[model samples]
Target: MASITLKTPSLSYDIHIAAGLLRTLYPRLKKLYPAKKSFRPIIVTSENIWALWSKDVLASFPEPPTVLFHPVGEKHKRLAAVEKLADQMVEAGADRDTLLLALGGGVVGDLTGFLAAIYMRGIPYVQLPTTLLAQVDSSLGGKTGVNLATGKNLIGSFHHPLAVFADTNVLATLPPEELRAGLHESIKAGIIYDPKLFKYMQANAEAILAADPAALTKVVAASVKVKAEVVGLDEKENGLRMILNFGHTLGHAIEAATQYKQLLHGEAVAWGSIAAVQLAVSRDALSEEDANKIVNTIMTYGPLPQFRADAKRLVTLTAGDKKRRSGRRAFVLPKAIGTVEVVYDVTDAELLSAANSMLTLMKAQA
Candidate 1:
C-alpha cells in the first residue's frame, strides 16, 4: 500500500492506495469518525457502480447505509442532480452529522462532496473513488462541485475529504477508454513536476496500458505525491497550485463546448495538453522536439473518441474558466518536460490558433 498525506489550511487527510483497501474502509472510518458521534453513513454512487461494488462496500459496514444512486455520466453532473441528492438526504433526515461516502468516480465524488459541503452548512465526507481519473486527480483535491450549463465546475466549493480510499482493485473493471482517460491526469502530473515519473510512463507504456498492478501502483503513488505537495503549498489555487491546471484551462473549455457529452474529461485534457504544448512552442517557451514528445506520449494511449465543436466556440468558452482574472485567463504552459509556468499574456488569437491546430490534428488522426 502507498499512502500520501495532503495538508491544507482548511483540512488535512491521508489518501491510501492499495488493492483491496475497500475491505479496510469500515475500520478506517471507525478510527477517523469514532463511535462517540451519532453519524450516519450515506453512500453516494452511480447505478452502474452500485450494481458492481455496492455488495463489497455494504459488507464493510455494521448496518446498511443510506445508498443514493444517480445515473452515470458527465451530463448528469449539474445543479439539478445536486438538488435531487439534497432532497433525498433531507428525506432521510440527514444533518451535519451525516457522513457522506462518495463511492464512484469523479462525478459521484464531486456531487457527493458538494452535497456534504452545503448540507447543514457542512458535513464530513470520505472519498471512495473507483475510477482511474478520480483516483489520480479529482478524488484528492477537495474540489467538489457540479457543472452549470455555462461551464464546467463553475459552481463548486473546496471541501476536503476526511480520508480518501483509492482501491486499485476496482480499476481492473474499468473500460479501456476510461483507463486511458485517467492516464491523462497522471501524464499532466509528470509534465508539471516529476520528470522521472514522466519517463516511467514513457518506458512502461505497454505495461501501464496492460494495467499491470506494479506499474499502475507506482504511477498512482507518484501522481498523488506530486498533487499532495502542490496542494500542501497552496490549498486554494492562489499561486503555486495553478500550475496543476496545466491542461485544464482549455480542457475545461473543451468539455463545456462539447456539453460534457461528447468527450471524457481526460480525453478533453489530452487534446488540451496538446494545444498547450503547441502554444508554448509558438511562444518559444518549449522546444518543438519536447512538444512532439509530449504529444506522442498522449497519443500512445489515445485515438480519443471523435467529437466536433467550433474553434470559435472553444475560445469563447475559455471566458468561463475559473482561472480567468480581471480581463485575462491563466494558461499553464510547459517550459520543459518537468516544468510549467502559469501566464496570462496569451492572446485570444493565440488560443484560436492552438484550438484550430488541435482540431486539425484530431481530424488527421481520426
Candidate 2:
C-alpha cells in the first residue's frame, strides 16, 4: 500500500493506493466518519462500473448505499448532469450531512465532487476512482467540474475530497484503450515535474503496458506525489499549478474540435503534448534530440488514436479555453523532458503552426 498526504489551503487528505483496497472501504469510512456522526453515504457511479465491482463495495458496507448512476462520456459532463444528480439526492432527503462517494472514473468523480460542492452549499465527499486516469490525476487534485460546449472543465470548483481510495485491483477490468488513455496523464506528470518518473516509465514501458501490479502501483504513487506537491503549493491553479496543464491547453481544444466524441481526454492530450513539443522546438526552447525523445516516448505509449480537425479550427477553439486569464491565452510548453514553462504570450500563428505539425504527425503515424 502506498499512502500520500496532500495538504491544501482548506484541509489535508490522504490518498490511499493499493490493490484490494475496495474490500476494506467500510472500515476506512468508519475511521473518517465515526458512528457518532450520522451521515448518509451515497454512491455516485455508472451502471457499467457498478456491475463489475458493486458486490465487493456493497459487502464492505453494513447496508446498501443509495446509488445514483451518471452516464460515462465527456459530452455528458455538464451542469445539467450535476443538477439531475442533486435532484436525486434531494428526493432521497439528503442534506449537508450527506457523504458522496464518487465511485467510478473521472466523469463520476468530477460530477460527484461538483455535486458535493454545490449541494446544500457544499458537503463532503470521497473519491473511489476506478480508472487509471482518475487514480493518478483527476482523483488527487481537488479539481471538480463538468465541461461546457466551449471547452472542458469550464464550470467547476475547488472542492477537496475527504479522502481518496484508489484500488489498483479495479484496473484489471479496464479496456485496453482506456488503460492506454490513462497512461498519458502519467506521462504528463513525468514531463512536467518528475524526471525520475519519466525514466521509470520509459524503462518499464513494457511492464506498465502489461498492467503489472508493481509497475502500475509505482506509477500511481509517483504521479499522485507530483500532483500533490503541485496542488499543495497552488491550490487554485494560481501560479505553479498552471504547469500541470502542460499538454492540456491545446488538448482541450482538440476535445472541443471533435465535440468530445472521437478521442479520449488522455489521447487528445497525448497529441497536444506532441504539438507543445513542436512549439518548444520552434521557439528553440528544446533541442531536437530531446524533442525527438519526448515525442517518441509519447508515441511509445502507442499509436495514439487519430482525429480529423482543421489546424485553424483547433487553434480557434483554444480561444475559448478556460485557462485564459484576463482574455489572454495561457499555454504550458516544455523546455525539456522534465521541465515546462507557462506562457501567456503564445500567438495564434505559433499555435496554428504547432497544430499543423501535430496533425501532420498524427496522420503520418496513422
Candidate 3:
C-alpha cells in the first residue's frame, strides 16, 4: 500500500491506495478513528454502487450510518441534488463532527465532497472510490463541483476529503466502456505531469487495456501521486491547476453539446484532446510530432467512441467554458508531453476549424 497526504487551505486528507480495501475499511477506519462516545458517520453513495456493494460496506459500520443515494451519472451532479443530500444529513441529525463516507466513483465523490464542504461550512469525509477514474484522479483532489445547465462544472468549490479508500477489485466489475473512459483521464494526467507515464503506456497499452493487476496498481498509484502533488500546491486552482483541464475546456463543450449523455466525460475529453493537440500545432506552440504523439496516446488509451455530434454547436458551447476569457473560446494546449499552455485567446474560427479537422481525422481513422 502507498499513502499520500493532500494539504489544502480548507481541508487535509490522506489517500490510501491498495487492493482489497473494502474489507479493511472498518478495521482500518476504526484504528485511524477509534470509536468515541460521540463519533458517527454518514455514508453517501450513488444508486449504482448502493445496489452493488452496500451490503458489505454498510454491514461494517458499528451502527450502519445513514447513506444518501443519488441516482448515478454526471447529469445528476447539480445543486438541487446536493441540497437534498444536505437536508438528509440534517434530518438524520448529522453534526460537523460526524464523518462522511463517500462510497462510489467521481460523481459521488464530487457531489459528496461538495456537500461536506457546504454543510455547516464543512465536514470531514472519506472517499471510497470504486471507479478507476476516481481512484486515479478525481478522488484525490479537493476540487468538487456540479454542472450548471449552461456549462460543465461552471459551479464548484475546493474541499478535500478526510481519506480516500480505493479498492481496485471493485473496478473489475465496471463496464468495459467505463473502464476505457477512465483511461482518458489517466492519459491526461500523463500528458500534463508525467511524460514518462506516456512512454510507459505506449509500451504497455495492451496489458493496460487488459487490466493486469500489477499494471493497474502502478498506473493508479502513480497517477494519484502526480495529482496529489499538484493539488497540494494549489488547491483553489488560483494558479497552476487550470492545466489539469487540459482537454476539459473543449471537452465540457462537447459534453454539453451531447447533453452530457452521449459521451462519457473521458470520451468527450478524448475528442477534446484531439482538438487541443491540433490547436497547439496550428498555433506553432508545438511541433506537428507533438500533436501526433497526443493523438496516438488517446488512441492507445482507447479508440474514441463513434458519436454523431454537431461541430458548430459544440464550438459555440466553448464560449461558456470557465477557462474561456475575453469572450474567446480557449484551451490548455500541450507544448510537450508533460507541459501545457492555457491560451484563452483562441479565435472562434480556429476552434471550429480544429474541431472539424479532428472530426476528419477521427473519421479517416474509423
Candidate 4:
C-alpha cells in the first residue's frame, strides 16, 4: 500500500492507494472512527457499484454503520441527491461526529462530500473510490459539489475527505468505455506535468488499456501524486490549482451543452485537449509539431466521440465554469507535453476556432 497525506487549510487527510485497499477497511476504520465515539460511517453507494462490491464492503462492516443508496450518474449529482443523503444521515440520528463513507465513483464522492460540507455545517467524510477516474482525480481532491440549473459543478464547495481508499482491484469490473474515459485524465496528467509519463503511457497503451495490474497501478499512482501535490499547494484553486483544470473548461462545456449525456468527463477532456492544443498552436504558444504530436497521441489511443452540437452555445457554457473569474473563462491550453497554462484573456474567436478544429479532426476520423 502507498500512503500519502493531504494537508489543507480547511481539512487534512490521508490517501491510501493499493491494489486491494478495500480489504483493509475494517481495520483502518476501527482506528479512524471508533464505534463507541464517532457516529460511524454511512456508506453511500450507487446501485451498480453496490451490486459489484457491496458484499465485500458489507462483510467488513459487520454492524456495518448505516447505508444510503444514491442513483448512479452525473445526472443525479445535484441538490436533490445531496438532500436525500443528508436525510438518511439525519434519519439515522447522525451528528457532526458522523462520517460519510462515499463508496462509488466521482458522482458519489462529489455529492456526498457536498453533503458532508453542508450537513450540520460540516461533517467528516471518507472516500472509497471504485473507478479509475475517481481514484486518480475526483476522490483525491478536496473539491466537492454538484451541478446547478445553469452549469456543471457550478455550485460546489471545497470539502476535504478524512481519508481515501483507492482500491485498484475494483477497476477490473469497469466497462471498457468507462475505462477509456479515465485514460484521458492519465493522459492529461502527463501533458500537464510529466512528458515521460506520457511517453510511457503511449508506448504501453495496450497494457494500460488491458488493465494489467502493474501498469494500471503505476499509471494511477502517477496521476494521483500529481493532483495531490497541486491540491496541497493551492487547496482552494486560487491559482496553481487551475492548472489541474487542463481541458476541463471546454470539457465542462461539452458536458453541460449535452446535458452530461453526450460524453463521459474523461472523453470530453480527451477531445477538449485536442481543441486546446489547436488554439495554443494557432496563438503561437505551441509549435505545430507539438500540436500534431498531441493530436496524434489521442488518435493512436482511439477516435474521440463526436460532440458536434453547437460551438457558440458550448462556449457560452464555459461562462459557468468553476474557474471563471471577472466574467472571463480561465482556459488551460497545452504548450507542450508536460506543460499547460491557464489563460484568462481567451477570446471567443480563439475558443470557437479551436473547437471547430477539434470537430474537424473528429469528423475526419469518423
Candidate 5:
C-alpha cells in the first residue's frame, strides 16, 4: 500500500492508494470512528457503482450501511440533488454523528462532501473514490461543491474528508472512457508539479490504460503526492494552490458551454489544457517544444471525445469562473512542464486566440 498524508491549516488526512482496499475497509473505519463512537456509516453513491461493488463494501461492515443513491452526471450535481440527499438522510434518522461515505466518482464525492459540510453544522465523511478522477484529484483536495446553471462548482465548500480510500480494484470495472477521463487529471498533476510523474505516464501509458495494478498504483500515488504538497502549502487557494487549476478555468467553461452533457469532466479539461498551453506559447511563458510535448502527452491518453463550441463563446463563459479574485480572472499558465504561474492579467484577445488554437487542434483530432 502507498500512503500519503496531507496536512492543511485546519486538519490533516491520509490518502491510501492500493488494490483490494474495499475488501478490507471495515477495520480501517473501526480505527477511525471506533465501535464505541456509535457513529452511523451512511454511503452516498450512484446506483451504478453500488450495483457493482456494494458486496465488497458491505462485507467490510459488520452492520449493513444505509445507502443513499445519487444519480450520476454533471447535470445531477446541483443544490436540489443535495437537498434531496439531505432529505433521505433525515428519513434515515441521521444526525451529527452520521459519517458519509462517498462511494463513487467525482459527482458522488463532491455531493457527499458538500452534504457533510452543511449537515448539522458539518459531519465527517470519508472518500471511497472508485473512479480514477475522484481517486487522484477530487477525493483528496477537500474541495466539495455542486454546479450552478452558470458554471461548475459555483456552490461548494472546502470540507475535507476524514480519510480517502482510493481502492484501485474498483477501477477495473470503470468504463474505458471514464478511465481515460480520470487519467487526464493525473496528467494535470504532472503538468503542475512532478515532471517524473509526467514522464512515467508518457513511458507507461499502455500499462496504465490496461489497468495494470502496479502502474495504476504508482500513477495514483504520485498524483496524490503532488496534490498533497500543494494543499499542505496553501489549503485555501490563496496562492500556490491556484496552480492546481492549470486547465480548469477554461475547462469549467467548456463544461458549462456544452450544458455538461457531451463530454466527461476530464475530457473537457484535456481540451482546456491544450488551450492553456496554447496561450502560454503565445505569451512566450512556455516554449513551443515544451508546449507540444504537454499537448502530445494529453493526447497520448486517448482521442479526447470531440465537442462543438464557438471559440468566442468558450472565452465568454470563462468570465463566470468562480476562481476569479478581486474581479480579475486568475489564470494558471504553465511556465514549463512541472511548473506554473497564476496570472490575473490574461486579456480577452489572448483567451480568444487560445480558444481558437484549441479548437483547431480538436478539429484536427476529429
Candidate 6:
C-alpha cells in the first residue's frame, strides 16, 4: 500500500492506494472516527457501479448502508442529481453526524462530496474512487461540485474528504477507453511535475494498459504525490494550485461545448493538453522538441475522439471557466516536460487558434 497525506488550511486526510483496500474500509473508518457511534454510512454510487461493486462494499460494513443510486455518466452530473440525492439523504434520517461514502468514479465522488458539503450545513465523507481518473485526480483534491449548463464545475465547492481509499482492484473492470482516459491525467501530472514519471509511463505504457498491478500502483501513487504536494501549498487554488489546471482550461471548455455527452473528461483534457502545448510553443515558453515529446506521449494512447464544435464557440466557453481571474483568463502552459507556468496574458485570438489546432489534430488522428 502507498499512502500520501494531504494537509491544507481547512483539513488533512490520508489517501491510501492498494489493490484490495476496499475490504479494509470498515476498520479504517472505525479507527479514523472512533467517537461517532451514531454516524450512519450513506453509500452514494451510480446504478452501473452499484451493480458491479456494491456487494463488495456492503460486505466491508457491519450492516448494509443506506444506498443512494444516481444515474451514471457526465451528462447526469447536474444540480438535479445532487438535489435528488439530498432528498434521499433527508428521507434516510441523515444528520450532521452521518458519513457519506462516495463509492464510484468522479461523478459519484463529486456529487456525494458536494452533498455532504451543504447537507444540514456540513457532514463528513470518505472517497472510495473506483475509476483511475478519480483515483489519481478528482478523489483527492477536495474539489466537489455538479456541472451547470453554462460550464463545467462552475458551481462547485472545495469540500475535502475525510479519507480516500483507492482500490486498484476495481480498475480491472474498467473499459479500455476509461482506463485510457485516466492515463491522460497521470500524463498531465508527469508533464507538470515529475519527468521520471513521464519516462516511467513511456516505458511501461504497455504494462499499464494491460492492467499490470505493479505498474498501476506506481503510476497512481506518483500522480497522487504530485497532487498532494500542490494541494498542500495552495488548497483553494488561489496561487500555486493553478498549475494543476494545466490541460483543464480548454479542457473544461471542450466538455461544455460537447455537452459532456460525447467526450469523457480526460479525453477532453488530452485534447486540451495538445492545444496548450501548441500555444506554449508559439509563445516560446516551451521548446518544440519538448512539445513534440509531450504530444507524442499523449498520442501514444492513440485516436482520441474528434470534436466538431466551432473554434469560436470553444473559445467563448473558456470565458466561463472557473480559473478566469481579473477579467483575463489564466492558462497553464508547459515550459518543459517537468515544468509549467500559469499566465493570464494569452489573447483571445491565441485561444481560438489553439482550439482550432486541437480540432485539426483530433480530425487528423481520427
Top candidate by lDDT:
5
In order of lDDT, best first, we have 5, 2, 1, 6, 4, 3
lDDT of 5 by residue, 172-223 (tens): 8988999999999999999899999999999899999998988988999999
Evaluated at residue 221, the lDDT of candidate 3 is: 81
Tell how far residue 27 is off in model 3, in angstroms.
Answer: 3.5
Candidate 2 weakest lDDT stretch, 10 residues: 30-39
lDDT digits (tens) for residues 1-366 of candidate 1: 888999887778999999988876787888886568577888899889988887778777887889899889998999999999999999998887789999999999999999899988999999999999999999988889998888888899999999999999999999999999999999999999999999999889999999999999999999999999999999988999999898888888888888888889999999999999999998999998889889999999887777888999999999989788897899999999999999998999999999999999999997
Better-scoring candidate (lDDT), 1 or 4: 1
Instruction: Assess the local accuracy of residue 6 in candidate 3 as a C-alpha lDDT between 0 and 100.
Output: 72
lDDT on C-alpha atoms for all candidate structures: 0.91, 0.91, 0.82, 0.84, 0.92, 0.90
How many residue pairs in model 3 have overlapping backbones? 0
Better of 3 and 6 by TM-score: 6
Model 5: colliding residue pairs:
none
TM-score for all models, in order of appearance: 0.98, 0.99, 0.94, 0.96, 0.98, 0.98
Model 3 misplacement above 4 A? 9-11, 31-37, 325-330
Which clashing pairs does model 2 show? none
lDDT of 6 at 196: 94
Per-residue C-alpha lDDT of model 6 across residues 126-169, encoded as one tens digit per residue: 99999999999999988999898998877888889999999999
lDDT of 5 at 141: 80
**lDDT at position 36, candidate 1:** 83
**Candidate 2 per-residue C-alpha lDDT over 1-366 given as tens digits, one digit per residue, 9 for 90 to 100:** 899999987789999999888888988987887668787899999999999999889878988989999998989999999989989999998988889999999888998999999899899999999999999999877889998888899899989999999999999999988898899999999999998999999888999999999999999999999999999999999899999898888899999999999998899999999999999999999999888888888899977988889999999999889889999999998888889999989999999999999989988987
